[model samples]
Target: MKGISILGATGSIGTQTLDVVRNSNDDFKLIGVTANSSVDKMKEIIKEFNPKYIGMMDADSAIKIKEFCLENNFKVQVYSGMEGLIKISTLDEIDIVVTSVVGMIGLKPTIAAIEAKKDIALANKETLVVAGELVMRKAREEGVRILPVDSEHGAIFQALQGNEIKDLKKIILTASGGPFRGKSKDFIKNVTLEEALNHPNWSMGSKITIDSATLMNKGLEVIEAHWLFDCNYESIQVLVHPQSIIHSMVEYRDASIIAQIGSPDMRLPIQYALNYPKRKEKVAKEIDFYEITSLTFEKPDIDTFKCLRLAFDAGKKGGLMPTVLNGANEVAVSLFLNKKIKFLDIADIIEDAMTIFEEYTHNDITIDNIIELDEKVRKYVINKKG
Candidate 1:
């Protein structure tokens, strides 16, 4: 059985990953699980999987989980903080580390797992967006496989499986166009939190849902594709497919386009990552082609969704620019959710932060440098509001 450690086990991706594991119990074992502060959910997972280790970033939450486990006479080790998450990633028996945690907080543990030679089923795009060069280089040095978990990247990986890299022309990533697809710039400028969170196809965390609405999620995927496929920024293209049936596509130089189609379920991609080079049967939705009328595609409106343009700019700038973009966007999203900033300000804050820190460049992306840059950008954004 392949021992698996799932970071951010309480989130949407984590829950779906556990579902995949549950369906294929004979092929996999849950060795470790980590969450930010969802103690009740973590406790429930621990009771079901009885993983050898569990981690929580919040100390009180971890202690509460430990207490509950003790009350129930359960035997499971509990840990807290970033160190705890890092330790869980390096568990000796773990063959695959699913970095499904959201945000930049996932970077350190993912790096630790790679250093330990654990195969990475990566869902944390921020880890790559902020430090793609460093993470990819470390994976190569350690000879560890960095498998893509995002449906788009996973589709590209599957499409390129048997094809020679030299034959590749470009990667065409599909977007659902989100809930605000055709909204005019004026309409989107006044959008509320509920509208942004209402993703048309994929059910995801709040942050990702917002990113999807703004098309920034697709932009980040472009950066991810560049690193994963060793392609330049020009080789990645984003197309809006409102149906979301086609996760992503790859075009060969010979004018052939290969695409992966599936129901919009996270479990399928998670299972595929776990059982790489193989297929597994699980309880997932099946596509009904007869009932579906048609598939529509359009060009993304970069005029309104400026986040997409900003992300492309960061990716092309390379090095620390992507990190700054990711960091500033994270802070901006938080502010928007808190009602401190308007929805449009999310793009404005990121763009402003990038301009202020233009001198940092892509080569200045040491871990310490990224952490400092992230803090600096957050402070700059917060102060700008005041």
Candidate 2:
């Protein structure tokens, strides 16, 4: 059984990853888990998985876990803060680290996992969005397998199983278009947080749900696909597929399109990543073709959802620009989530930050550089909002 560590055990992807582990039939062992202040959920994971190590991004939560473990005689080690996260990620027993944590916070721990020679089941897009080159290079150097856990990237990985990179044409990422697919800017302007969070197809955390509503999730995925598949920005395409039956597709050089189709479930991708090079029993619900429906597609409304456009621009610009884009977006989304800004302002904030940092250049793409840039961008966004 392969030992596994989940870096965000309390989030949407993290819990789904746990389901994958739970159903692995002793093929995998849960070794370590980490979360950000979800003490109640973390308690449940500890009782069920009995992982050897636990990390809480929130210090008070870690103290609480320690107390709970002490009272219950759980005999598990608990750590706190970023150091704790890194420690869990690099545990000696963990052969694979499933990084489902959101935002730039995921970058450092993922790098630590790669450096520790642990194969990565990557669900965090911002890790790549901010430091794709560095992380990918580290994985290559350590001979670590950085598997894609996102549904779209997982589909692309599956479709390219037997194909050579040279035979590949372009990657097609499908977006469900969130809660406001066909709505105009006028309709989106006054949209409440609840309305934006009400995703039509997939259920996710607030940040990503907002990103989806703004079409920025697809944009981030575009950048992620570029890094994962080593494809050019121009070669990546996003189509609005409302049904979400097709997670994603890849077009070959000969114009043959291979699509990975299934129900809009995150578990499928999680299972795929966990069992790389092997296909286990199905853990996700299968799609029913008997319904006899049509799968339609449309171009993403980039003009209305300017975050998507900004992501593309940042990705193409390269260097620290994508870092700025992600960091700023994280802050903007947080502001919107807190009802401090309008939903449409997310793209505007990100764009303004990008514009401010456009001429910025970095000598090296180190973790320090990425983290510093991320901090700077976040501060800039908050100050601008203020």
TM-scores, one per candidate: 0.98, 0.99
Residue lDDT tens for model 1, 1-386: 99999999999999999999999957999999999999889888988999989999999998998899899988888999998899999999999999999999999999999999999999999999988989999999999999999999999999999999999999999999999898898888888998889888888999999899878899899999999999998989999999989999999999999999999898888889999989998657999899799999999999899999999999998878988888888888888888888888889888988999998765456888988888887788778873
- Cα RMSD, each candidate: 1.0, 0.9
Residue-by-residue lDDT tens digits, candidate 2, 1-386: 99999999999999988888888899999999999999999999999989989999999999999999999999999999999889999999989999999988898899888999999999999999888999888889999999999999999999999999999998999999899999999998999999999999998999999999999999999999999999999899999999999999999999999999988889999898888899989998878898847989999889999889999998998998999999888999999989999989888888888888876635478778887878888888888895
Q: Which runs in model 2 stand beyond 4 Å of their true positions?
A: none
- Pull out the clashing pairs in model 2: none
Q: lDDT for each of the candidates?
A: 0.91, 0.91
- Candidate 2: residue 19 lDDT (0-100): 87
